[model samples]
Target: MLNYEGIAASKGYAIANAYKLVHPNLSFSTMKIGNPSKQVKRLNNAIKRAVNDLNKIEEVVITNMGSASSEIFKLQATFISSPNFINEVSSVIIDSKVNAETAVSEILERRISKLKNAGNGKFVLDKIKDIDDIRKRLLAYLLNKNMSDLALIQSPVIVVSEDLTPNDIIQLSNKNVKGVIADLGTNTSHSAILTKSLNIPSIFGLNNISKNVSNDDLIIVNGMSGEVIVNPSNELVKEYSLKITKYNQTEKPLDKLKKRNAFTKDGKKIGINANISSPKEVNLIKNYMIDGIGLYRTEYLYIDSYSLPTEDEQFNVYKNILSSMNNKPVVIRTLDIGGDKQVPYLDNNDSSERNPFLGNRSIRFSLSKTIIFRTQIRALLRASIYGNLSIMFPMISELNEWYKVKKIINEEKRKLDDGGIAYKNPKLGIMVEVPSVAIMADQFAKNVDFMSIGTNDLIQYVMAADRGNPTVAALDNPLNPALLRMLERVVNVANAYKMDISLCGEMACNRYALPILIGMGFKNLSMNINSTLDVKALLSLLDYSLMQKMSEEIIKNACTVKDVIKIEQRFIKI
Candidate 1:
């Protein structure tokens, strides 16, 4: 038996034969186009063929995985229509008189150049692997002239791959898919989140599972421990089965608390909110008495696309969430990209920086992509008609940036009015992530609807620690006194303005931070859906007034994580 360690993405246990997915060999060579007209025609023909293959893949996905998973084919379509991508490939293909695969390689090289210039060479390169895989599949389709057998399954499959794109992850049908293990992925990756949502076992960044493990090998995967047992004996399987049962049995109790309130023993109300990326998650809006969505990220619709989503597409997504809330407030935070999140369509060449977190990203990128920003505003405004929709601009530091956002929003409103589209005024807000913004929260509260503290970014920013960096992962402490003080300031300012204040970050989900947040006057606690009931139960068992009294000490003296935990333990006991 072989064992390896990786980050546990989704929790579960499973024993199944590994189904390893092999990627096609990628090749690239640049071509110089002598005739623009001829090159254009060739490029168009190639794209058409690629689209036809994607249609076949879509049909295959629908037949094999179900329609819900087939929505990912849209990503393949976007790749086919990439303007910079198409132009670059056409230039190389026509100039060099090479095969499409070689042309794609040259195009990839060009993308590497662009990525390097954008200052996130490694991040962009990782993302480009997905693009290249699509190109290779398209090449295979062209060579074979048939994708009919694409749905053929090899079953009782434990799907293993180097990684999974959001598009590929959906094509999985739970009927035959026992579990999934990958060589690369993060908690926020589409595959990881989807697996968690589906209650499947998943482990990521497991270095060499593909090379070490052969096909049809019986493997026992323990997601909680990030371990995969190769060729497990019957005894281990039986042991794991019991473990799974016990885990489920424990969780069976939390289900009943879903509908209940999160009021503490002293009757202090704790509002629960959910973090979301797509409008499809709107189904979760009324599952309980959720205060609202804390973070409705809009990046999913923009990233992996050749062109920005149409205004109608953006509006439909926003409107659905708005309509589903049924008078419940929804806070939609504008695009948060960079670090790991990237958009293929943006032609950013300034890649000289080291830390993308501190680079020209988030609101800075939003300002750069004016068309995208304007289109998003138009959709948010249209969706506002459905219910109470509050718009929050992310990564705000300087006050001037907020003014600029307000200016653009006003322009979008004017355009909507001119076009006779009905829209209610949305409560404008800002995400207090930067320390500067947190310190100046009182000033911002006067200009916006409410202040939503995004402690995840705030913690990273204040500590100068990259949360994704394993070397400094221990230093990524949201419990740091600096971050706590900022949260206190934000909550105080919001309360002074009679504005709603909430925390929607990884920190909000922390059992230790719960009392501190409640103590600091934060009414709403937005977190992952799975943790909602547990937090509610904990809240119901605690005394918020005591924590409120101790909030001052928690923020003033607590500099390390140990200090923060000690404070919470004492407050909770009281």
Candidate 2:
């Protein structure tokens, strides 16, 4: 048996034959065009087809993994579908007077140069990979050639690739693909996220993993430990086969929690909600005992196209999601688009902002254009009659901002009433992302129906660090004394008013933070659908009352990350 070790990307065990996936040749020489108009038409059609393929793959990913894993593809589709993209392609076709393929290859190559200038950091490197994927998709379609479609494979095989793209990893998940071995990517990469979403045993960061393996070679992949064995001895295979059975036995218990409600040891019911972006993800989590859809990221509705989704279109999607929950609460946060999430189609998106994250984002952009805000509110209100719907606004930094948004909602409601449209009144809420709101949580609690602490931004805003940027990403810590204090204050106010309060940020997914939040008296908790079961399983073992007392000491005495860690370790041992 020959063994190799790499970074574990996804947890599972697989024993199958190997299939090597190689990158397609995207290089093409510039050729003279017959007609500029015809070439432009051809380029446009190719782009449309590419964007369509990305969209379909995105839906499959969302259904399989939820919205976060699907985001990479969504971004790729948004880039290709933008007017700016087509305009540049058209300019190249006319200016260079070259064939459609040559124009595309040239434009993409020029983009590569601009991206290279951005820097060689991990983020830049990831973008380069994304561009490469886009380049491959466009060239393949234009040239009428097929790339490896693992979905078409009839039997199970372990895929080995030089560098797995989001496109490649997702396609590998079609069926009969037992595992993935890739030479590039870390657990944080888009490729890794796709493999995990598909529940494929995958190991990335292997050196020339593709070159070392041959097609139909017997392979064993242990994703939990990042172990890959080629042509293992019969004894070794039998041993791992038992381990796989044991591993699956442990995982199936979490599946039992699918139909089980989340309750603390003391019989206190805790809410476990889903934070999803697209309506389609609702189908994946509906069977789980999620309290509700805590956050419906409406920005995805805008990112999928060159123009905004019409009121009817938004209404239908919202209705489907709300209906699927069957009277369970659904919190739809309206248009949190800006910062890392951008929609170029909207005229109101201010590209010139020096620091876009802190300026004209979320509620600010939504309010900047009342028509856009009104249209969404009208849709949400119309859909409210179908199930329990709560409308939440993001990035409200002031009481007046909340008041201004409420005024717009009132206007939309009146317009619906005037048109004789039947709509139920939804519980109105605001995301407590800004420090200003968290500082005055008590004051705001009086004005809103509920509060959801979006710790992803609150921690960053409080710490003055961008989570997306690696240089300062560590400082965006949920365990920071400052952030913990702010969170403590918000939950206290929510407890005082008997209002529905929940943590729906990245912190909610943190296992360490979970017990602390529950101890701090958070009955309502929301996180990604993928993490929901684990959180619930943990809930049954936790004594909420005991956690509440432990949280008090951590809040009072824990001063640093190390301090928090020490105290949590002591408490967990109990």
Candidate 3:
């Protein structure tokens, strides 16, 4: 047996022959020329076909996943049909005296170049991938060549690739895709996100898995542990095969937990909620016993479009989510942009700063750009009338930032009142992602209706390490003794103030952090939609008293992450 290690992107188990994902040769000479009118006609015809192809993929995503997952295709379709895009490509064909294929390639390259120079934010980086897909797809149509045929996949196989784009990942859905292993991807990569959303067993950043594998190589991918074994002997294959079977058996019973509320054996209950981006993501929780939408990232509403979403457009999306949940608690976070996200319209100068992550971002960016902030606040306020709503401000490091957001929200509410618009006063909250906020939780709790610990940022900020940087990624562990102590203090404050507090981050779904959270008095835990069931199932098997005991020991004796991990491992076995 040959073994390889990788970063786990999505969790499951698979044993199958490897099927390599390919990047088709769409390369063509830019000097190729044709009759000007003929080239323009071919360009128009290719655009129409590409749009049709996108629409079909969008349908597949919506049917198998949800409409939220299909937003990429919608954006593609909109861009392709836009007047500016059409004009630019057609002008290239006629003015440059080039073939339609060459014209499309040139325009796509120009767009990609523009995006590449748009600094390092995820918004620009994601668009680079989107435009790359468009370039290949359109050129293939013009040249009458085959693009990826993932949609036509017949048998179950583990997909190995140098890198899989979002467009490639989407079409592999409902097509017997056993697993996805990639040579390059991170936890936040679009391909990684898509695989997780589609519930496919996947691992990425395998270095050379794509190059080493052969046509007949049998692969066993354990997405849970990020392990891959190639050409294992009969005994080992049988062992791993049984593990997969047992894993499936265990998962089946977890689904039956849908209607059941999560509670400790001692009868203490905890709220299990989902972190979502778009409004249509509510559809993803229909089969699960989700307490509510804990973290509704409103950033996608702006990110999904070419221009800023108007007040009406934002309001409708918010309304749909609230109405769908039927008065269930929906905590809508106001545009948490400018950190890893950026847009050209929003004075993107800050995005070019030396340390953009520490620069203007989240609530900071919102306050600086009042129009964008107020527009979003007004829409969120209007949507409050539809169902239970809690509006949250993210990355508020100080009390002053908290006060500014509230003042602006009140100003918006007043304008709504003057306009005779019906709106509800939403329960206000702040994310405790900043160490400053976590330390001052007592004071912040006194002001806000609730608090949520955004551990994704909190850990990185507190540790002074970027999780994306491999050299310092180990520092991002939630098991760090100082973070646990800080969380204990925050949870204690919330309990003392009688305020609702929850954690909505990757930490919330992590098993190692589960006991510590509940033991520290957290009654609410919000994570990705698919993770709710696993957490809920584990919640039932735990005893609140034992968890509290274990937490007490770790808080006192665990001075390092290694100590905490050791304690957790020992307790997990018990």
Which model scores highest in lDDT? 3
Per-candidate TM-scores read: 0.78, 0.72, 0.85
Instruction: Rank the models by lDDT, top first.
Output: 3, 2, 1
lDDT of 1: 0.72
Q: Is candidate 1 or candidate 2 better by TM-score?
A: 1
User: Number of backbone collisions per candidate, in order?
Assistant: 9, 0, 0
lDDT for each residue of candidate 3 in 1-574, tens digit (9 for 90 to 100): 7999887878989888888776667777766565788788888888898888778778877777677668788788888888999999889878989887777878888887776566433234235557876888888887788665565556788888888754466577755788988887655444666587678888887888889987558999899888889898999889988998999898898878888888887899899998876566687677777789999888767666645677898899999999999899999998887655665545554548888769888888889878888988998889889999999998999999888888888888889999999998889999999899988988998899999998888888889876444345557688899999999989999999999999888788777888888888899998888888888877777889888988988999999998998987777652
Model 1 agreement with the true structure over 1-574: per-residue lDDT tens digits:
7777766667778778887766544333444445555645655776787776566667766664445345556566776677866777777666676655566655765665664466432233234545555656655553444332223454666778777755455555434677888877644344676676556788877766778888789888888778888888789889988987898898789888877877888998778888876565676546766777777888777663434577798888888787788778788888777765666546442364577778888898889878777878888898888888889888988989989999999988898889999999888888888989887877887788777887777887888876554345546666677778877877887888899888877677666777787888888888767668768877887777787877878777777778878877765663
- Identify the runs in model 3 with alpha carbons over 4 angstroms from their true place: 17-29, 32-52, 67-96, 105-133, 140-174, 183-194, 205-218, 230-238, 338-351, 568-574
Candidate 2, which ten residues in sequence have the lowest lDDT sum?
119-128
> What stretches of model 2 exceed 4 Å from their correct place?
1-30, 33-245, 347-352
Clashes by residue pair, model 3? none
* Residue 401 shift from truth in candidate 1, angstroms: 0.5
RMSD of each: 6.8, 8.0, 4.4
User: What is the TM-score of candidate 2?
Assistant: 0.72
Give the total clashing residue pairs for model 3: 0
